[model samples]
Target: MSDIDRSPKAPDLYVHYCEHQGCDNWGSWGKSPSAAVATRWWCFEHFPHKSFDRNRR
Candidate 1:
């Protein structure tokens, strides 16, 4: 058998899919300034709205 037979199939990661459910918009790495939140892949619609801080003007 050839070495190719032993190789594992690569996963089809729709890697840029938005973190939000039911939302298929293209996504990218997202983050919040607050230390309490973890960074994750988010779409353009949600990326600017993720916030942990309550105090705002």
Candidate 2:
């Protein structure tokens, strides 16, 4: 085993695109367990409007 901190890190450089139908933004928000959100991903622009309902309240 190796000692490493693999926790989530901030997105400084371009990682990936949002999983929205036709979005072209970088995916800043996403699920950890992979079974929470339907699309499982959304950019900082669309997450609040789409995944909030399922995640919060």
Candidate 3:
């Protein structure tokens, strides 16, 4: 069997806008795996004029 058939299928991955309510910005972001969980993720946004501390949460 090919790699696609050997491994369990993963659903399509998509970058959704940050779930921070009231902010409907279609974020052009990417997903990163959370350090605490293998199945969890963090979405990073590209805000050219702003600074963010990813480790602060």
In order of appearance, the predictions have TM-scores of 0.40, 0.42, 0.27
The prediction achieving the highest lDDT against the true structure is 2
The backbone clash count of each candidate, in order, is: 0, 0, 0
Q: 1-57 in candidate 3: lDDT tens per residue? A: 566565457788875564445666655553334667433222343442232345434
Which candidate achieves the best TM-score against the true structure? 2
**Candidate lDDT (C-alpha), each:** 0.66, 0.69, 0.46
Residue lDDT tens for model 1, 1-57: 776685477878766677888988877856655578765667877764626334322
The TM-score that candidate 2 achieves is 0.42
Global Cα lDDT for candidate 3: 0.46
- Candidate 2 — which residues are off by over 4 angstroms? 1-14, 33-39, 48-57
| Model 3, runs deviating above 4 Å | 1-15, 34-57
lDDT of 2 by residue, 4-34 (tens): 8675877687476788789988887865534
Candidate 2's error at 12, in angstroms? 13
Candidate 2 worst ten-residue window by lDDT:
31-40
